[model samples]
Target: MKIKFRVILSISIIAVTTLMFVSCASDPDSSGLEYMPDMYRSPAIEPYVDYGEVRGRENKDLKLKRSAMIPPSGTIPYYGTDSATVALMMPYARKANVAMKSTHGMYDAVLTKENEYDFALADKNPLKLTSDNMGDLFDTGKKLFTANCAHCHGAKGNGNGPMVVSGAYVGVPDYANLTNLSDGQIFYSIYYGKGMMGAHNSLLDKREIWTLVHYIRKFQDTDYGTSQSAKALEAN
Candidate 1:
């Protein structure tokens, strides 16, 4: 009976071992994915497109006139101060100070010396004779010249004005003959005064002298006598 029991026990153990070995063998297709149906396949993962809160663009349905709606950026404020008062006022006072400083800082320095002219300074804006438009510049120039330069250079720029007539000065240049003189040369002489003349550099600013030069050119082409006659008739 013992031998029979041992035989039955050994058979049962062998059967259980064989079943365990079969289960451990490589599976043909027991993977969870292998049993999935075609419909169970996940749809292709589409990329995300979140556009609800994006800045700088608007997606709307509307129709309107053609116009721009861009708002302007804030502008920076601009401020300036006039510190050139000293430069402005100094030229005005410079004329009378000629006694202490023989060379007036402006054009007057040229009057103290002769033949030795500084064209660089004279050609500057105070003597811009070349920029007379519609003769207004010349008219202003003439008025200023009559007020300032006529004393010695003469009312006609002919060196024979009241000052020269009274023997107060000599050697004023004739503007009629200035056809040979460049605008720069004429401006130089006016700025620094030639011969017995003193520098107007102190008495006049650059623009004033330039305007005067512009008017001087008008006298070159104009018949002063005719104009004077016309004016005299108009006065009557």
Candidate 2:
């Protein structure tokens, strides 16, 4: 009977020891047992909210000045995941603009030496020149071009697309002709109107226009007439 009692007592002591050990363990709340390091957590959200607010404020300020925003609910596209994917996949896709169709109709005056000259192409659509393997700049240029210039320039830099031909536009210089102009010249023309072209500096920011200038220069050789004048002008 004493032996059995001693055995039972030993078992009780073991159970109490285990309970004490468990109780002494670090508290889940204090020990960060359930907490995760930032590395394990999601990436910090880009400040889209602040951006939206700032953009909204800017829009209000510029409402009376020439408005550049694409009309709400218009077919003028906002960038999408597909745009980025397509840009990555194909050079042709990267040059295409989302705003082309709308920009086609914005022209009220037509200036054409012949029915062949297309000015709407330059007037509406913006370009996206991807620099030498500068992917981030390329992506940014692509988005800006789509947002501001696609309406007239078409999806590709090729001038044969819907926007220019379908709308009330003429003298739209094709991308081929535009390429002959150097980056500085292109920026100059965009800033100060040459010929019938209006100044886009008021509408597009500098980097945005410069990026488009490169994109337009890319297709200018294959699409339209070229001039040594751009070369001569550059030399001078």
Q: What is the C-alpha lDDT of each candidate?
A: 0.53, 0.47
User: Each candidate: RMSD to true structure?
Assistant: 32.5, 16.1
Clashing pairs for model 1 are 107-201, 108-201, 110-192, 111-192, 126-206, 126-210, 141-211
Residue 188 accuracy (lDDT) in model 2: 51
Model 2: how far residue 174 lies from native, Å? 1.6
Off by over 4 Å in 2: 1-133, 220-236
In Å, residue 43's CA in model 2 sits off its true spot by: 39
Give the candidate number with the greatest TM-score. Answer: 1
- What tens digits encode model 1's per-residue C-alpha lDDT throughout 1-236? 99999999999999989867655637655323323343443344223432322232443432232234333433222323443423322332112223324433432221223233433333333332222243566677777887877887787678788988998777777888875555556656666665456566657766566566556656776632234544223212
Q: What is the TM-score of each candidate against the true structure?
A: 0.42, 0.36
